[model samples]
Target: MMEFKRKALAIAVMVATSTLTACGGSSSSSDPDPVTPENKAPTAVTLTANTVEENAMGVEVGTLAATDADSGDTHTFTTDNASFVIDGTTLSLAADASFDFEKMASVDVDVTVTDNGGLSHTETLTINVTDLLDYYDFVSEFDAEKSSVSYSGQTARHALIAELKNYIGNGGLQSDVDNGELSSKEEIVAKLNSFYDRDENAWDGFAVTFTDAKQKFFSEISSYKSLKDKVAGNDASGQHALWNGESNEAGQYTGENIAFTGWSTWDDAPAHVPADGVIPQKTPHGLVQQFFSQIADNAMENPGGKRYIHGAEQIEANEIPVFVNYDGTDLNQLIQKFLLMAVTYSQATDDYLDENKGLATDNTGRDKGEKDYTKLEHQFDEGFGYFGAARNYLDYSDNEIAGKVKTEEDGRADWNGKHDTDGDGEIDLFSEFNFGASVNAAKRDRGSEVQTDFTKEAMDAFLAGRKLINDAAGTELTTEQMAELLEYRDAAVLTWEKAIAATVVHYINDLRGDLDKLKAGADDYSFTDLAKHFSEMKGFALGLQFNPYSKITDEQFVEINTLFKDAPVTELSEIDEYQSDLVKARDILQAALEFDADNVENW
Candidate 1:
């Protein structure tokens, strides 16, 4: 029986073994079937929105993060906006991306994080751009009231022209000219003074008499009393005004009204209206009539044309003929001369005297006594008017007036270089009329307080000098204070004269360069081209004659004129003949002006 059981168990065991062997044989030598795990989607990512200032560089908005329950899952990041860039799980503004608060205040970006398994989560990011000017502290320090003074000179100019017109229309000028009693500008001017002194009656053709016009003009000149009062208290109006004043000394108020002194002192005076015993190409009477006629005609022709030349294309001859100084000085040159004198000379000179003499200490003794407007203060404000800048000249962000402060080369209201659009080395009359103002502004701006900004240095210097006078208005200045003030004035004068000298040097170099180009076989030569250069040279030479306080002597003036004669040198080969003469003239000017070549180049 045991033998039979053993045999059965063995048979069972054999059967079990045979079953295992058969299963193993079916699977061969391979491992058991692997269990299949369920796939899980990645968790949605939550990214924080970021805020950055405008013009922020390389700022990271946020890092994209995600969780995947399934192992070995990889993730990628992206953004919908081109300005946003994605790398791995991180997101940031693109390298070259920039923002302008003026243009766009903020930007919103949508970001996405995608897992290797194709699951994605998106979040919107917000970027806020802030204005740079808003945080700037200097904006508040800028004096807008002081800046508004820049237009006062223009007002004075218009008033002077009106006065001249009034004098002419009253028939004083006509009667004098027709009777040959006013054979020269000096005689005409003297006769006009008699009319002013007598309060001449208006003729049948006139709207106003000379006395009425003088009153109106003086009113305009006195309108700056408010600005002047802000700095000091000494009446600078009446005869002491830059256009009407007469004094044996530069800054002294003689209380004598030298009628139309501004017109008589102008460099173009002899040309526009001949002085005593001299002949004029165009009489002041004729010029004034022509000026008014042209203006009336232009208004009828191009009714919408701008009154001033702002760019190259706007420099048409008859449109704004007063903006140029060539072919001898025009009415505009007369106006500019007055404006410049008001700023750099009249006001500047008076301020120096006030500092040295303490004229404002006893305002009761001066003309228009015990007034709120001091001579020093009025002079300073008068300067602003002639500068032709807006009240916010320092606010470069102010698009309306910022151009006034910008450099000529950068194309900001630069009527000077703009008229030279052809690169022919010669500038139009527009440039000639506008060049001195621009050059003066540049010289004045180099001393601005703003490090990164262009401001009027000359204007600032004037303001500073005025402030010194104003501070000492009620008090007598000590000898030390006087010396200090005089020193300041002297420094300013040096800078101004240097600036003018530098401009002369630049004109010389331009002429020299053009000649060099001609000698080098440039093909752009023509009779007109040579004439244009000669004209420019002559125009600049004429300017040298009017250097502030006559720094350019008679000999220097004669030498310059002789060197740059108006001869019709149409031949290109003949340009070289003038080279040595030009160099000699240049060297003479440099020596006379004490201009260092390196320093002049900087100007």
Candidate 2:
């Protein structure tokens, strides 16, 4: 009776097993289907591994078991293949499956369990799988690759190029350009890639090539002929030629004091010198005085060999400028000029068409359908208007602005203490107001650079050195009077606030251009291909050129115009709003300079 009762209890327990297990499911009625030992489904299962490292024997066996929810059955385990074992409620490991990790490197064993109802589970166990020698070998190989090998092939070169492009496109090293010798293209690139290949761009160890083939082509042409033809030949006027002569002045002369040889004084000198009793010769005094004394001595301390000279400063007043001339040309300027020219050209062409409408209607004598110049008027506005204000701000940086400061003491001492010089409790009256108005006086009197007491005593020396030019409307003003107004306006623009904002804008533009070029290059040629094909080339054929095409709309032009219309009047913030203002200011400045090129005051 006891044996029969135990069997009945076991059958009841087996029947109740299905209700006890939740199958790791939620309380939702739409619960996932369950796995059963009879017909096993791919149910989610978690695997566990255990070892005996905490024991003195240095060996242990790990057991695995599988149970089914819908069918109550003990999982069967096998060990003939050194995998698993089976019992009743639990699956025990066979003795042969025990691991000895003390003497061996590592041991791996695979275990698989199959329930009587047919559910199965499998797992791999890894034990003590490490070696000090393997770690040392990995370290040696990695160090060798980093230090001794070039980053050739697709994967390595792609990474290197991406890093470099990011550094440049993001303006990562702007200080290097400003305060160091890495200013030029070659210097900048070499400084960036210094660790890998310092002289990577050098051609055959003798010459360096520029990727911009146009510049190289001109350089080669000038190398064989005269530089003047290459430079000034861009226009009919010889103005460009003057620039070439000015820039190449250093190479023209071998001796010193070429600086102090003022053409104004030298042209006035006698046919014979009092000391030499001959036509004034290149004397030792002139050489030392002009070259050594007048210029910065530490100019040529870099590998690039850029030098400073006093004559270079004076070249501005002569036909040949002492320094590189700012021609007021860039993408912004180009866009503005193109727009202005297009407008005027369109107007002119429209007038022509109106007068010749009869001929146009008759279709005779070249009716001039859609003049090309007229089409160019809104080229930038139509095609590139999408860039909007952010692009504009990039052109107008805080660094480009001139900053000036004057002390309160200097202001008070010079003028008669009528104006408040430092916003302090002090009044400075004129001798002459230094761009300051009298604080106590309520009329808002404008400041004067010249004295109100313009006596003959003051006028005699001043008028002697003065020269005059016509105003915007072509009306003449005395040079002294013009200088006063111009200087005042210049001072107003040179505030610390203005300079900082302008510098920021300029850098933003630089960064934007870099990013744009990188993107365009990548789009045209995948980075992998570029590194593989042009990695060794001195200059890449990335084609970083600006060419304006037609097919723009009036709405686009208006958007472009708005970028310049709402420029900053004072300080510009560093955030997005200020950035937008900068773009507008840049566009305006560009338009002002380009549209009114003949007007000197616009700059």
Candidate 3:
């Protein structure tokens, strides 16, 4: 009996030890620390479109999955939209109509997932649905169409005539041929070269100046009743005098007032240009601020500004109602996306401004109350740091990926088969994807208003600060102060990035709401109807394999495959290879996100 009791005691001890091990306790003195429950939610929570094929109900549809950092906890998924379902790790739609799936057009949903410990993480999802030509295919078609149009040669003569007129109006060609600015052919060529080689903004300013002057001359003709009658004939003089021959007039006329300047460049030309010269004399680097100013003015003007005036007018003239057939989706979703990108960029600019303030000025032994060191520190933070964050956000979209391909100042595409930025054989995202028939045209293209606006503001502010510093003469910060400034700026950048990430997450949650609506009515859900209704989500209507957030690289695939091997339902062949590249991108982004999260100086 004593021996039996000893055996029973040994069994009980073994059982207790096994239970402790299961609970993640150390078994020996040198064993690692026990797994402590973290109060913090996932550091990088993400939702990605995993599949667009038919679900178990056999309807063609889209699918998304959510992941958390704490792998062991039970998580609950809920959405702002009605009809969403959560069945363990899977969330599926159960809508009741054949049109239900089609009805699910574009929708933004807020998604909140609470772990077993009650810690919650929130994200936003935007889903858009539409049937447009593939972006890459459309780019090819548009380029081809443009080429064919160019080759027709009908507009070649007109183009040359217009160029000559512009040259005369812009003062590119000597208005007074006897004016001795040029003494030889070489001198003329050099002068011409300078005119041709003028920076982008300078060229734009000159063209604008000439165009404005020409408009003023026509306005003057219209204002004079006597001159109007004289120039009313369909003769060369009438065309020259800003009258397009609406009436027949005197038989003889001469082209005298065809080209005339109303005032000096200062009064009519863009701010960057000078009164004496047709082109703006500012440096190439200074053009961005001038561009911003011009854009701002245009936006404020009721007639539309120079920046997007042409684009807006075209849209109004060719407006095609996108949501006429969509009852389940909101068409304004695309507009909202534009607003979101714009607002985010705006906020980023503000953050950059605040961070870069006083970076360029003299702080050495200034007046007692002067904000010396902080100013310079803030400038550094706002300039480089702020821009870095904005760049990452731009990279998230495929625009920058292809921006390299479009930019050719030095005559080389970024994807010339030699420099693999992604080290993948193919030129990744932006290079491959185009807006095609997508509703969100700006998102797919780099150098968009959203990006351009913030970049200009940030750069302008930085330059202003730089001038201040230069003006400060020899005044400088101490070594310690310099180091501190660097640290502060670095921290500020991380904070801005985190804020941007949060905003992006919010949009993703909005998308989840649409999913919920479909799931709520799953019983009668018709995938076709849901898709039809979700037309507003066309921009967000990503295929499972090509989600924007999942910028995959090669290395990440191997890591995730190793980690998720123990999960149920043994289908690795299909998804594993497909997601490998995405995994790499996600891993890099995740690291960056976490780093930013930890740098709490901005808070």
Report the lDDT tens digits of candidate 2 across residue range 102-190.
23555555555676556666655554533221100011121324311111121122122223333433334344444664555555434
The whole-model lDDT of each prediction reads 0.44, 0.26, 0.32
Question: What ordering of candidates by lDDT runs from best to worst?
Answer: 1, 3, 2
What's the distance in Å from true for residue 419, model 2? Answer: 62
Worst 10 residues of 3 by lDDT: 147-156
lDDT of 3 by residue, 557-592 (tens): 234323222111112343334234323433443464
Q: Model 1: per-residue lDDT, tens digit, 1-603? A: 999999999999988879988776564557577798765666666566556667665677777776677767788877778887887767777886767564578888776767776877676656677655321111111232332112344434333433554454444444545566655544544444332222324222223233322223243343322211211112234212222233344454343443221022222333422123222213222223233333233333333334333232544332233222222223332322333433333343444333433333342112145335444444444433333333323322222222343564444453322223334554322111222343444532442233212234443554455555555554555677656655655554545555544545555565666566556767663323333344444433443433334456767767766775543232467767777676677777778766655544433
Ranking by TM-score: 1, 3, 2
Estimate the overall C-alpha local distance difference test score of candidate 3: 0.32
lDDT of 1 at 86: 80
The superposed Cα distance between candidate 2 and the true structure at residue 317, in angstroms, equals 32
**Model 3, which residues run further than 4 Å from truth?**
1-475, 509-513, 519-588, 595-603
Best by TM-score: 1
State the displacement of the C-alpha of residue 544, model 1, in Å, after optimal TM-score superposition.
4.9
